[model samples]
Target: MAKLLEIRWHGRAGQGAKTAALVLAEAAISAGRYAQAFPEYGPERMGAPMQAFNRISDEPITVHSHVTNPSIVVILDPTLIAATNVKAGVPADGIYLVNTTMGPCEMRKRLGLTDSPAKVYTLDATQISMDTIGRAMPNTPMMGALVGATGLLELDQLIADTREKLGRKLRPEIVEKNIEAIRRAFQEVAS
Candidate 1:
């Protein structure tokens, strides 16, 4: 939390990338930190590719624009690796948290990032979400991975905030299941 932590989220429409970014921003604000979250859309349809950005820091964020260079990048759809330059603008020390069934090592090789300085982490978030929430949504689980990989916020705080934010619009059971997904994803993400 010493410097601004910028995060870029890559996901398709209906995958909850925007929702996850908003939730993470809200969680950061709830923890008394300054944050910003917003989404960039393309075709504006389900299954269309999109991007979301988040900036969390101890100080106020003065910039209001897309995050071209992110400290962390969360890829909700592994397919984007082949479809887009998911690693664009990322520095050597950046971290990539990808939602994929493949292990990190395999993912690195698949993405041809074995020589890259950026650290790569992978988690079967879709499986975790399907198992816990009965859906294939990877956004919530990816948030857990984001926290786990970055440590920008505490795990408990994230769960509490997620429950509170989603509790209003969703069923109690769904909320609980999402929390479980988050917890499992946090623990299960592999480097």
Candidate 2:
């Protein structure tokens, strides 16, 4: 990437938004890109709204504040659409990858992006995770959807990095299933 890329992720508290940000940063670093990831939350409990941010560039990252204007915005919970301003800080040319049963056209309308230049992509990431990982975590699958939308990272490498990170805390079978979720989302996302 010639310029810095900022990505903001929105999800419920227990949905792995923070984990996804960390994995995305680690995966980018493994690819020789400079990156940073962090989460923003208060005393929110499970299923509460939360956000995570990522900054990625070929060169070193300097800005340490929250991502106010993101080039990419990812929403891991479809229900957040009704309660959150998911488009906040997104630029006119920004991209949105949403976890939903809706297609891009429907998502565009839902997000009020019909006349905006921003691009929209959609996927039933929850279903993908449930089917592959036997859970509802959408983070890893959303990471793959992000890759599918932008070609930002090598899919196999991201999966490898995710596996390595998840392997530290998860069982081998669960890790493999998450990897499957990622691959499935990458292929199934509607652009």
Candidate 3:
């Protein structure tokens, strides 16, 4: 049986939280896994906080339940940590990919975080996105951190899948920039 991976995304509407989930699911499927992606909508307005989820496994996923015990929790917005219980329902050893420049120690101080068992990979995806894509939307760069933090998929494959998934939504130049961002993030993980 293939290992299962559940991911929960916390971000505002229009920030590509849903897109991120879909892209990840698609990538997994392309890699010969069963995957599903969906989002929970609320208030239904841009900038309103929302959640998206993904499930991937070798065996066919039969469960239709919302993810309450995600293996990976991605925080696309740093503010969501304060605004919502972003850590809710995560396993003690769950991995967190947070978009921030703050080091783990500094992040703990800035967020006033009490010690938690979950491991975290923090990156300035906001800055990386702005520099790479010329926008503050961090979905693509956040994918880089995800790849870096966890060797869930091949970095090149992920970037290729992402480009294919986002091709029409972004210009060719932007796509190239995003590829560069992912490369940088992959190197960041190695160094």
**Shift in Å, residue 133, candidate 1:** 0.7
**Per-residue CA lDDT of candidate 3, range 84-183, in tens?**
9887888877877888777766665555454866677788878877887788888877877787888787887788798998897878888899888777
lDDT by residue (tens digit), candidate 1, 72-188: 889999999888888889888788899998999999888778888878999999999999999899999999988897788999999999999899899999999999999999999
Query: Model 2, stretches more than 4 Å misplaced?
Result: none
Lowest lDDT block of 10, candidate 1: 41-50
Candidate 3 stretches greater than 4 Å from native = 109-115, 189-191
Best by lDDT: 2
* Better model by TM-score: candidate 2 vs candidate 3: 2
Q: How close is every model to the real structure, measured as TM-score?
A: 0.97, 0.98, 0.91
Candidate 3 lDDT for residue 133: 74
RMSD in order of candidates: 1.0, 0.8, 2.1
Q: What tens-digit string does per-residue lDDT give for candidate 2 at 1-191?
A: 64899999999999999999999999999999999999997998999999999999999888888899998999999889999998887889899999998989999999999989999999999999989988789999999999988899999889999999999999999999999999998998887
Clashing pairs in 1: none
Instruction: Name the lDDT value of residue 6 in candidate 1.
Output: 89
